[model samples]
Target: MAKIRITQVKSGIDRPERQKLTLKALGLNKMHATKEVEATPQILGMVRKVEHLVTVVEVK
Candidate 1:
């Protein structure tokens, strides 16, 4: 299975609760935090929800 690298590039202090939860679900609950997750649809959806608070890079 393929995987992606997720990094908390920006803070989510004033962002919506749902967005914060999305980041947390992706294992990036803090500023500058980085996590690697399988490239599954469920994870992708979560990332999309918090796209504004994080950066994603493909892991080959």
Candidate 2:
């Protein structure tokens, strides 16, 4: 499986509960925090949910 890097570029403050939780689930609770994760369907869905709050980059 290919890996991707997820970075929390925006703050979760004032966001919905679900978004905040998604951020946490992505191992991102702070701004600029980055987590390398597999590009699975489930994880991709989660990332899509909070796409506005994060940035995704392919991991070489």
Candidate 3:
């Protein structure tokens, strides 16, 4: 599987609980925090849910 990097670029404060939880599921707990994970369908779905709150980059 390919790998990708997810970085929490914005604060989760004031966001919906579902989005916040999605961020947590993506291993993002704070602003600017990053996690490298497999680019699986599930992970990609979760990223879509919080796309506005994070930045994603494909890992070479």
TM-scores of the candidates are 0.91, 0.97, 0.98
Each model's total of backbone clashes: 0, 0, 0
Candidate 2: give the clashing pairs.
Answer: none
Q: lDDT tens string, model 2, 1-60? A: 999999999999999999999999999988999999999999999999999999999998
**Could you tell me the TM-score of candidate 2?**
0.97
What is candidate 3's CA lDDT for residue 1? 94
In candidate 3, what are the lDDT values of residues 1-60, reduced to their tens digit? 999999999999999999999999899999999999999999999999999999999999
lDDT of each: 0.86, 0.96, 0.96
Cα RMSD for candidates in order = 0.8, 0.4, 0.4
Residue 12's lDDT within candidate 3 is 98
Candidate 1: lDDT of 15? Answer: 85
Better of 1 and 3 by lDDT: 3
Rank ordering of all candidates by TM-score, starting from the highest: 3, 2, 1
Cα misplacement distance, residue 32 of candidate 3 (Å): 0.3
